[model samples]
Target: MSRSGGEKERKYESDESRIDSGIDSYKSISRDPYWSLQSSEEKDKSSCGTEERLDSAYASSSLTVDSLGDFIEKCSISEGENATDSENNNEEEVNLLTTVTEDGDTILHLAIIHEEQHFAHQLIELFPRELLDIQNNLYQTPLHLATYLNQHSIVKDLVANGVSLELQDQDGNTPLHVACERGFWDCANEMIHNASPNKLAHVLEAQNWRGLTCLHVATVHKQRRLMRLLMKKGVNLNTQEGTSGKTALHMAVELHDVYMVNLLLNSGTDVDAAMFNGCTALHLAVGRQDAAVANRLCQAGADKMIRNMEDETALDLADGNDDILALFPFDDIQIMGRTVINF
Candidate 1:
């Protein structure tokens, strides 16, 4: 089944043209893949033909792993050849790199997903920065997937190559969110320590759809180590969650976490920072009947007089708890060298 060089060239050109034309047509029609797919599913139910064509183009462009390796080998061979053939090879490389699966996963994505570490490393070297950020159907960039899968080297390489660290997955989680949530220290460190100084703040503080920042996630997950790392990286400790406006201290207090409360206090967290309902950590501690955490907060100078939306102060919420009520004094008080009350 051997063919002449001319015949092989013609076949390559034909396949390339079909793939390229299909990709261009898809781009022209669907600017946002997720939205377009949804519209086709719900309102434009009759557009099945259009959807099929799009799917066909995506599927047609997918190369088997072996095919990809062989094509990449051919591209490497053409690198130092004459100008015309080199130009053709470069065009083919671009087309191949941009080809996505029906799930919108590029070859680079598949390589990482399949844990082809050696091949993934090779492809990372070959891909341009823009190509490194191609998101799959789940809106997971290769960096997100790599972090979620705990691939430290891939995370390092992707960050070193300057991929956007702020690209959120379908769940609105940045790679940092995934790293912090999963307690992956090395992967999280690569992102925090290597990100551009100006941009690192945004990455650290970026919230998910649920309004939980990386620090909030770490606190909720009880990741003190990651929380400390984030704090050292200058994350805003007092940033509130989007839903209830509860800071990390607020969460720690509600969890009856005395150690966490002390950690936040020592870290200079705003002890009286309020939630959306004007409830402070002190209020939550007192209401939850957590005598230990409430005492810890009081020792750390938590304001007992701050009222909640229900017009209840921590003292008002301390219904019949002598241990909690004992921490408060009717006169002005000083704890941890901070004045917590004013007459």
Candidate 2:
């Protein structure tokens, strides 16, 4: 009977060991990271059966299991908080770059206007190409500001990185127009030589609000070298100004610039291109009593027969100057009731 009792006791001990082994396996699965991924309600539902078993099997271990659950919950909350903070940080960074001031100037605009070259460089690299063309309150883009400020390096960088060359500021002036107007050849050259053939063509033809192309600007500013640079790029020699319908050649003659006159003539300018008042360069020359200019126009194949709005030809405007009248090949000239001989 004693030996039978011993066998039963050993069997009971083995069964208890099996119970502990199963509980350890359950605890291991509960500690899995996969469980941490579940929602709080799902985790509670999943753990309910295990929790009831733990409480029934060992009341003392219930506290331990509850503490472990709490630890995981805290960890999950901490991770979520970190994730939210990370998102906020990323948004703030983007806003820092994109935010505009009351003047509608972006950080990049201010950087350039303030002559902060180093900061501008950093911003340029950080900004997307389209953002490089953003205009401020006055409708001036970064490129416009750069050109206006004569920032040659910035202009080069902006153009090389694919900023839109056609964007106009408040005055309808493109960056190229500003460069030309200011005689900033370094800035102008960067834009002109770096542009695609089609784009350069379009820009050369683009006019400002004053109805002046870059060529006209160069001429008005007496930027001879700049004018030559433009002409070399295939600018339209006979493009008329919007205000007066006068070409660059007309302005050159009006400015009494013999060098410009010769330059335009050699560049195939329309010698007899008329102005708004139906006046040709020769008409203005003869009216100004500039015999030398009249002679030059005559030599360049100027049509002296072209009449002005005043119903007068270039010959008619040469009132009494034999030197002016002599430039035309008229054998008989009647001027101020004087019969003159043409040379």
Candidate 3:
């Protein structure tokens, strides 16, 4: 052979040797003695799944070919192993063993996201522990995820499995708060009134990173029924968020949610509670040019003379608001000219 050919053969030999070494190294480490039990456990699933797949493969292949005898033999061996695992109750126990992802999600998390009720049931039957305590990277628990996704059955399963009813997320907000924030009225009601401790007072008034309470979220989502439910649960209508120092009524005004505003007012929320901005709900109504809100506030004995940071009164806020004046009767608007024009 030529010298170049000899060199090429040598190099090829070296590369093949390195490749074989790498393969061996990978198998050795992956099946390391230190992880013998785990490796053994891992093989059971992979081998079983492969056997199942092969069984299906043969069944499909039989449609095109005459002989599935060999495939059937292989599948029979696998079926025997599956029977053994089943008889030993390993299958039930294995499925229930909680598996946490790198993101801290339990098997329940995967079930909820994938809508795998069968798989979820397997998990539940195995562990039967609430395991709802597992939090995702977002710092929300399984209940929070289920509530946000509106997974009714999963919520029931989790509650029955013993997940703490008052479990709070990193933000100190509970699952009920998340449900309310996401407009999952049924989930919220179920969590609060049924499965949970009905500590609605704590949850309804809980704040998120923005210091917005459950009522604030409900108003934004126009979840009036949830609002009524929360109110019936005795959520303090006047609860003020620390960040904005805004009451639920102020939040309603900010959202321009007429229904929520009416609900809040009817619930006896202090319509006059001033926020950190020193603006009352009345000022918000006047600023939004919602004369109906303005009229409602004034009729409800809301003092328009309330001052904000700028020391401007609600009447002074009416100067450029033609839309707001449009809400009042023409005669009322004209007569309100007697209203003080502080601006």
Candidate 4:
């Protein structure tokens, strides 16, 4: 009887252990990530039309997915991806998304972030055609990012494919804008040399979200050499900023760069270019108490009577302070313009 009881107890224990083991296995199969992936694959293969199987895709009727699936669902499909279906008119979209994040970064963006040339090349190879296209997010194409990151080879590769240097972002910024703004001359040259010189020039004058052109950015950053390239690109020698009415010359005068002053003047930039407030470069110089710039502007034929919106002249900004006038001593110089007489 003892032997029988012991045997029965052992059997009961084994049965309980087997049941628990089976339950644990079922739990893993149900909850494991890999199992979920397999189930997804199986489901995908079974459904000839994936339109109905979109899990959480159209949970909200207003939210739309603009991707490969959208292309496939169209009824008027042409002749491209599949021959078996009567409607296969979908064009073979170049797979640009080597790695697209939920937030919309591509592999090219990652290449810039990592500074990985080899990785960039690999990603570029994944879809050579798409390399020329701008991304939906950040308003920067691969070419723009390459310019920003100073990747000359990457820029060369993309520009060779005819990436539109003229393509503007939501801000109206172009590839040249990115380069000139960041002071990346090498990258800017790569784009220009690869195309008709006229193509990027118009883009150079293209403004950004802030209504600032590439020339404006270069001036603000004090990038004198970039100013040279911009002039070569035919950026308006006299393009005035809309809000401030400050031209490249206006900012250059403020920076105390006499060379830039001469360059702008030689390039036909108006020394008397006025800002929104009607303050000319001379006015800006006076405001900064920079006599050198003031004298240079006067020599460059700056009209002394240009007034601000408030009717305050350059001298007025200086408060008719003799110390400020002493910097330029414009009254002493005999030029085409009369000395500003502050009453």
Q: Which stretches of model 4 miss by more than 4 angstroms?
A: 1-99, 122-131, 169-172, 323-343
Best candidate, TM-score: 1
**Per-residue lDDT of 1-343 in model 2, one digit per residue for the tens?**
0124554454344434333222234345445667535543343344443323221121122223344334233323222457666565665556556766544667677667546676677678768998999887667789998887788999988888989899887778899999888899999999999999999998999889999999998998899999999988899999998998999988888898999999999999999999989999999999999888888999988887887788778888888789997887756665642457654
**Candidate with better lDDT, 1 vs 3:** 1
Q: How would the candidate models be sorted by lDDT, starting from the highest?
A: 1, 2, 4, 3
Give model 4's TM-score versus the native structure.
Answer: 0.63
Tell me the deviation in Å of residue 216 in model 3.
Answer: 1.2
Q: Provide the lDDT at 185 for model 1.
A: 88
lDDT of 3: 0.61
Clashing pairs for model 4 are: 77-89, 78-88, 78-89, 79-88, 79-89, 244-275, 244-276, 245-275
The sequence of per-residue lDDT tens digits that candidate 1 reaches over residues 221-275 is 9888899999898889999999999999999987888888888889999989999
Query: Superposing every Cα of model 4 onto the true structure, what RMSD results?
Result: 17.5
Model 3 C-alpha lDDT per residue in residues 30-67, reported as the tens digit of each score: 33444333332233234342312211100111111112
Query: What is the TM-score (0 to 1) of candidate 3?
Result: 0.65
For residue 255, model 4's alpha carbon misses the true position, in angstroms, by 2.9
**Deviation in Å, model 1, residue 21 alpha carbon:** 32
Regions of candidate 3 where Cα sits further than 4 Å from its true position: 1-96, 125-130, 170-173, 195-198, 320-343
